[model samples]
Target: MSENLNPAELQKTCLYDRHVALQAKMSPFAGFMMPIQYDSITVEHNAVRQKVGMFDVSHMGEVFVEGPEAEKFVNWIFTNEIRGFEPGKVLYGMMCYPDGGVVDDLLVYREFAPDHFLLVVNAANIDKDFAWIEEHAKGFDCTVRNESPVWGQIAVQGPESEKVLADVLGLPEAANLGFYTFYDTEYKGKRMIVSRTGYTGEDGFELYTSIDGTVELWDRLIAAGVQPCGLGCRDTLRFEAGLPLYGDELSAEISPVMAGLGMFCKFDKDFIGKEALLAQKGGEIARKLVGIEIEDKAIPRAGYPVELEDGTEVGIVTTGYHSISLDKSICFALVDKAYAALDTPLSIRIRKKVFPGKVVKKRFYQTNYKK
Candidate 1:
């Protein structure tokens, strides 16, 4: 998808110059000229796993919904329940189409009031997600605003993330943040939103600040010896932790149930895709997402064919890699439900060779979330 973008038309984040100064390999991603790697993917990957790393995540989109019907409107559109959401709490879920296909997976944050909420969505689906929300809000007494451009985001992820933010950035309030929670604080007298949330399966925080504040924070972290990470390691880390990337694991044609994300879908509420998802849950689902451990060193990639011993095609790989942390070739594949069970024998076609593999737990490594 990124290959088709014209470099001249790509957007630049506030940290673009900093990335160039560090000699990061910049590429067009999600309509933006973003860094793919600064040093090596392995080194950056280990930095986050062992110590600390920071990411320029300003490309993510943020939308605000505020009104008397904010909770009701959010519940109607999203697959998760938000009945007990209070300020600072966040819920992860997907907005699905009527046919149960995913619209996008997002994090919904309950802000200062029950009538106000914030949504953090994928960068590539920002425009489309906002439009969908606006169109469905026809009869609700609410206000929907896309606030993507007004904020800049940086993710400080690792075991020492909190300490880095508190000591290096001098944001002492960061140490008090709880998992999946956020707090409004001040940095350099500028309002900032700090959340104990991250994409990597580690203890971390995501800070949202003004464009200028973002630049200052990035500089401060770099000066404090925090490694500047790029998207390459980000993918490997998230894959190792079994976190689903939107376009890879969940898509317009892939429902939450098929992606093994049924826990995030609440059936008691009447959501847009409730009927279809409930039916899928109660009936037979044709395919399901599962983990595959390749016996060989060959890496399996997205769109590779999955088959049984007799070469009968079953499904396709969604995301895969030679895991840096685990030192094994692993992949996430969407395959026939019959082959989704643990220990199921399977084969992945890589180039002209078919490599033997077995279905295992999707998570290659245990997450270290501070919950």
Candidate 2:
């Protein structure tokens, strides 16, 4: 954290200088000084939709788990099956407490060795998650280290990501890594980890390199025809893809199942939230996550009330944005189970006036993945 920044401590990412040099609009996000847009939000958002764009996601947290008991520790703590994920593969999962409340949503990337792995978590929840994981691994023969400060991450996403990466990034048979898998490589003599995973619903690669090499990598990619995208587009892109944001769609009070991530849960595995999730499964689900399309021009915002025809509030909007792809206002909500049906008519209370809306399938935008 830097001393010059205020309240939230405007942390700097590896590409902070590049953003300033590009004359980007800077803002505080998740306690970091991030570029909200380089040119314009909608223009950058549309650029990524059509071509490859890079993001400075170095503020994300990276934790290392090693030793013989690493696998056991992770399997017991996360609500996903680790055994099924082959080495060099990646899986999406959540860390939950005993009561089934989510700690954070994370991507678990298996290393070349079974006893080693990297956990990429949200920036804001790094300390909380690291403390929790460390305390849980007390007796286990595992070492948990917070390596976020030493590393930097960049997400190169969009339809043309493959072409851009193939030209700029040098790795070992790098292009051959399957989707959701990663490969060890070297860029400019520095050891790097390139994963075929990205938050955007686009076919892209996430490059993890040493903090020292961050600026060079960003420059190289930009020179290789990858546009620098900002946090604004990142949010709109992920939201349009129906990917849940940590604070909005998931949190300490929100269960993964309630966030429309029931498929990621392994019922057979006895995880921290297994008991509660199982109990909730046996009975009817009280609330369900759904996507809503606003018909009016008013953009629905988070914390807005979701009401029915009779003006009865049924849910609350969790995330909302103007979709560059859909050309409409879109939002996600945790509505009562009965209101989760597709095409269900609903209204979003915006500035005291109800805007017409309807529940729709979440994949509001499609992803282009390399087969």
Candidate 3:
């Protein structure tokens, strides 16, 4: 917390003051002054794994789509099938360019109203994503609104999340809802949403409400001794859970098909990137994402070259770590498709030495999502 950080003009979330008051390790992330850790990354990570932890994800962006053509418009831009999705249900997918590059990966919440939907996007891509959305919406008979400035969101995650949310917050309805579903209700005379979607691969709930309500909830949760997590632990938890970060795993150069997320992209219907993705699937794609487990304790970092047994460079590591939960060096890498098969011998170049490893399942840790 004492290191001199770069003085870049950054945006602040609704809980910025709370993090500062706690003396959290604040860093610039996604153009916002976000908390990297409160006490320790490992402590906060473990709290979310064994008990319950909370993250002030108020910096995430929110967009509202409403009109007679809302459903049609969303389905056109999104990769997933939202044609007949029921209200209160949420779908995770990507918005793509005509050439199949990802604009952003987001969660779309179907509202109870027949002609309305809400999109929760990444914090860093807020401006870019909204502009893309607005551009594509020119011909549609719908209205798009970037409501990120007014909304606040918090993710309460772990095995004990339900109990904490129900007992501490008195939101019993949260317990009644199932995974990937949400319910809208009034809190302190203001509208709010409670959704079950865990980015950490744990049973969790993300509460979206007014900024004041978010602050009050944070205060109460802290008073009740729930560990306040930050982006550092959030990254580790999500990585262990086998979730993909947008810029790292899926980017302008990486498509959902290339990242092994083709399951989320529906091909039966037409979308903005349908033809390009279809062509990519039908053609011989050069690179694909795979998991590599190194035998040594050497931690692999991003941009480190992945090599063949003969010292030929095949690809590079996208994300890697000495996994806290698994206690091994592992990473996600984009490699030549010819070498992506299970049990293929591979090596990662760490600084000056090449460490041998093998292709393994990307999901290094088993998740506990309560039914």
Q: Which number leads on TM-score?
A: 1
The best-first sequence of candidates by lDDT reads: 1, 3, 2
Per-model TM values vs. the true structure: 0.98, 0.95, 0.97
After superposing all C-alphas onto the true structure, candidate 3 shows an RMSD in angstroms of: 2.3
Q: For candidate 2, write residues 1-371 as lDDT tens digits.
A: 12235945577888888899989999887778889999788877887788888999999999999999999899888888998678998999999887777999999988997699999999888889999999999999999999998899998888877777777765436578778999887766787898999878888889998987777889888787678889889999999888998888988777888887877889887778888877766654688889999887788889999999899999999989878888898899999988899999999999879998899988899877666
Instruction: Assess the local accuracy of residue 344 in candidate 1 as a C-alpha lDDT between 0 and 100.
Output: 97
Over 1-371, each residue of candidate 1 has an lDDT whose tens digit, in order, gives 43448878888898999999999999888888999999999999999999999999999999999999989999999999998877889899999999999999999999976699999999989999999999999899999999888789999999999899889888777787789999987766777899999988989999998889999999999998999999999999999999999889999888999999999999988999999998889865899999999998999999999999999999999999999999999999999998999999999999999999999998888998887
Ranking by TM-score: 1, 3, 2
Name the top lDDT candidate: 1
Candidate 3's residue-wise lDDT over 1-371, tens digit each? Answer: 12224555688889999999999999988878999999888889989999999999999999999999888899999999998799999999999998888999999999998899999999889999999999988899999999998899999999999999889999877988888999998777788899999689899999999999899989999999999999999999998888999999998789988988888899999889989888888864789999999999998898999999999999999999999888999999999999999899999999999999998988888999867
What lDDT score belongs to each candidate, Candidate 1 first? Answer: 0.93, 0.86, 0.92
The deviation in Å at residue 146 for candidate 1 is: 0.6
